[model samples]
Each structure stands twice: as C-alpha cells, then as structure tokens.
Target: MHLYGCPMTRSTRVAWVLEEAGLDYHYTVIDLKSGEGFKPPFINLNPSGKVPALVDGDLILTESAAIGIYIADKVPAAGLIPAVGTSERALHDQWCFFASSELEQPLWLMAKHTFAFPPDQRCPAVLPSAEWEFKRQLKVLAQGLGDKTFILGEQFTVADVLLSHILTWATRGLKMDLGDEKLEAYRQRTQARPALAKAREREAHEAALKAQAQ
Candidate 1:
C-alpha cells in the first residue's frame, strides 16, 4: 500500500489511519508547492487533484473520508469501526456526515479567506463569520460527545479518527474558542493519541528529506 501526501496537508488522515490499523505503508511525497499534485499524473490517481490519495494494489482511492472508512473496514481486527447494522455503526455514519458537512465546510471557507486566496482576492470580512459558524457547529459536536471517551462511548472508532483530526486543525486554524469545556478536552485527547504522534514524526522525517534535497 502507498499513500501520497505532503506535510501539514490532508494526507494526515491516511497517515493516522495507517498507524491505527498497524499497517506499514509506503509514503510518497507529492510536492504541492511545485504543483506536482495537480499535474496529470497525480490527477489521474485522484481526479480531484487532492492530497491523501491511497493506493492498495489495484484499489486506488481518493477523498480522506472514503480512505479512512476503507482502511477501517479492511482491518476489522483493529476495531476502528463497529459491526455492520449495529447502532454504533449507524452513529459513525451520522457523525461522519456531521463532521464533513457541518464542521469541515466552514473551515474550508476560513482557509480560503486566510491563506488559499491572495490578499486582494481574499475576503477577510467573511472570515469572522465563518469562525462563528464553525464555533456553533462545534458546540453541537461537544454535546454529542457527552461523557464518552470517544465518539461512540469508550471505544475509538474510525469516525473519531476523521472528526478529531478535522477538529484539531479547525481549532488551530479557526482559533476555535470551544467555549464548551467538553469539546476542548476531547480535542486535547485526540491530539495526544499515539497514532497522531507517530504520524507527526513521519511527517517531520519526510519534511527533512524534502528540505535536504532543496
């Protein structure tokens, strides 16, 4: 298996899943700065031209959420997901959509205004608005988390892998003032996971390799 990614990119999703599943896969660095990720070759692998594309032999997958679910299903022994038809599985799907639709959407807006767009084209006025919307969404998520150690009670499911990562980045980038203490503690717990720790280590190593070649 191989994952194409760059440090600080969406590729963190695949990297974290790989650790969670105890899978050793090859990491291919796609230099987004030099436009390597958007070219025909990488675009062929992921038509969306996004980072965090995964290739497991003939099964080539794009979209971080799809990749996360695929990995969890493939490694059921890892317990990243609940059994099919179970209530927990249903909840996983529910929260997955909530994370992508409710939480992540505003973060994308904030990112566009803050960095992806140029100073002139960027809409600074809308940034505060996006942050407000994201904060509102996070409050709902905090309530859903309740007193559970993970998204589905005490067990760590693949949903947490995706949602937690999104929340962590949103917190850092959106300056997410999680007014809710539950959400803040949840964020801290997910960020401190061993899987995330290992992925950061690998990302640092890959970054050093890129720097030395420059």
Candidate 2:
C-alpha cells in the first residue's frame, strides 16, 4: 500500500487511520507548492489533482473520507468502523457525509477565498458569510455529540476522525470558534490520540526529507 499526501491537508485523516490500524504503507509527499499535483505522475493517480490518494494493489482510491473508510473496513479487527447494515454504520455514514458536505464546506470556501484563489479572484466580503455558516454547523455537531465520548457513544470510529479533523482545522487552522465547549473538548480528546501524533510526525519527517533532497 502507498499513499500520496501533503502536510496539513486532508491526507492526515487517511494517515491517522492507517496508523491506528497498524497497517504498513509507503508515504509519498506531493509537493503542492511546486505544482507537482498537476504534473504527469501524480495527475495520473488522481485527475482531480488532490492529495490523500491511496493505491493498494489494483485499487486506487481518492477522497480522504472514502480512503479512510476503505482502510477501516480492510482491518475489521481495529474496529475503526461499525459493521455494515447496522444502525451504527448508518450513523457513521451520516456524520462522515455531514463533515464533508456541511461542516467542512464553509472551511473550504474560506480557504479558497483566503489563499487558494489568486489575488484578483479572492473576495474578502465572502469571509463573514463563511464564518457564519461554520458556526451554524457547529451547533448541529454539538447537539449530535451531546454527552457521548465518541460519535457512536464509546467506540472510536472513523466518523470521529473525520469530524475531529474538521474541528481541528476550524479551530487551529482557520482560528474560527467551535461555538460549543463540548465540541472543543471533543476535538482535544480526539486529536490527542497517539495514532494522530504519529501520523503527523511521519508526514513532517517525510516533508523535511523531501526538502533536504531538493
């Protein structure tokens, strides 16, 4: 197994899952700043020109959420995901979709307008609306979480990984308010996992190695 990723991107979610599952996989740091994503080799892997693409034998998977789900399913003993056809699995899917579509959407918008877009195309006026939407979504997430330790209440599933990653991005990356104490504590708890730390360390180490080689 091999993963194409960049530091501080959604690829960390996949790396976290892989570490949690104790899976052996190779990591390749895509130099996004150098536009390697748009070039031939990496572009052939993911035409969308994104990081967090996984290649396992004949299977090539993109999308951080999908790749995380696939990795969890592959190692059932890790119990990172609930069994299919169960209510827990349904709810897991729900939070994953919510994270990607609802919660993460506003953050992505803010990112595009703030840095991803060229200066001439950026709209600073849109930032306020994006922040507003993010706070609104935080309320939904807080209510869904309630007093549960994890999303499914006890088990640490990939849904937690997905939601927590978004929460971390909001607070640490965007400096946006989580809007709820419960959400903040939840983010802290999830991010404190050893697997997540290892994943981050590995990415940083690989990135430094690439820099030295250049």
Candidate 3:
C-alpha cells in the first residue's frame, strides 16, 4: 500500500487511521505548496489534485474520510468501525457526514477567507458569519458527544478518527474556543491516543521532507 500525503493536510486523518489499524504503508511526501500536487503524476493519482490519495494494488482511493473508512474496513481486527450492516454502522456514517458536512464546512469557509485564498480573492466580511456558523454547529456536535467515551460509546471507531480531527482543526487551525468542558476533554483524550501519536511522528517526518524539498 502507498499513501501520497502532505504535512498538515487531510492526509493526516488517513495516516491516523492507518496507525490505528497497524497497517504498514509507504508514505510519499507530496509537496502541496510547491505546486507538485498539480503536476502530472500526482494529478494522475487524484484528478482533484488533493493530498491523502491511497493506492493499494489496482485500487486508488481519494478523499480523506473515504480513505479512513476503507482502512478501517480493511482491518476489521482493529475494530475501528462497526460491521457494515449494523445500525451502529449507520450511526458511524451519520457522524462522519455530520463532521464533514456540518462541522468542517464552516472551517473551510473560514480558511478560504482567512488565509487560504490570495489576498485579493479573500472576503474578510465572510469571517464573522463563518465563525457564528461554526459555533452553532459545534454546539450540535457537543450535544451528540454527551457523556460518551467515544462517538459510538466505548469503542474508538473511524467516526472518532474523522470527527476528532475536525475538532482539532477548528480549535487549532481556526483558533476557535471549544466552550464545553466535555468537548475539550474529549479532544484531549482522543489526541493522546498512541495511534494518533504514531501518526504525528509520521507527519513530522513528512514535514522534514517538505522542508528539504524547499
């Protein structure tokens, strides 16, 4: 298996999932800021020119959440997710979609206006609305996470892998205050997991590679 990744991209989510599954995969550093993502080879791997593209034999998977789900399903022994036909699995899908669509959507908007876009293209007026939307969605997420060790109760599923990272992105990337104590504790607990640590180790290595390329 080969994972084409870039530091601090959504690829970190796939790397975390792989660590939890104990999967041995080659990590290829693709420099997103250097315009390598738009070049032919990387573009062939993912037409969208995105990081976190996974290549396993003939199968090539793009999109960070899809890659997480694929890796979790691949290693059922890791128990990273519920069985395919179960109601719990349906909930897993629900949380994943909620995190991506509801929680992550505002963060993306904020990023686009904050720093991602070129200065001329950025819309400073959009930031306040984005912040308000993020806080509203965060409250919904906090309610969903009430009194649970993990998203599906006790077990740490891929849902947690996806959702926890989004929470981190909101708090760290967007610098939002996670107001609820439970939500803050949940982020700490999930981030302190050994698998996530291993993923960060790999990410540090990728960052070094990126630096060398520059």
TM-score for each of the candidates: 0.93, 0.98, 0.96
lDDT of each: 0.84, 0.95, 0.89
- Give a tens-digit lDDT track for model 3, residues 1-214: 8999987779889999999999999998888877898898999999888898999999999988888999999999999999999999999999999988988888899898888789999998998998899889889988888999998899998889888898898889777898889998999899899998898899888678768887
Of candidate 3, the 10-residue stretch with the lowest lDDT total is 205-214
Give lDDT for model 1. Answer: 0.84
> In what order do the candidates fall by TM-score, top score first?
2, 3, 1
Relative to the true structure, candidate 3 reaches a TM of: 0.96
Compared with the true structure, what per-residue lDDT tens digits does model 2 show for residues 1-214?
Answer: 8999999999999999999999999999999988999998999999989998999999999999999999999999999999999989999999999999999999999999999989999999999999999899898998999999998899998999999999999889988778788989999999999999999999999999999999
Please state every model's RMSD to the true fold in angstroms.
1.5, 0.7, 1.3
For model 1, residues 100-146, the per-residue Cα lDDT tens digits are 78988889998988888778989889977888898888878888998
lDDT of 1 at 152: 91
Mark the 10 consecutive residues where model 1 has the least summed lDDT. 170-179
Mark the regions of model 1 whose C-alpha exceeds 4 Å error after superposition.
none
> Per-residue error at 34 for model 3, in Å?
1.0
Query: Which residue pairs in candidate 1 collide?
Result: none
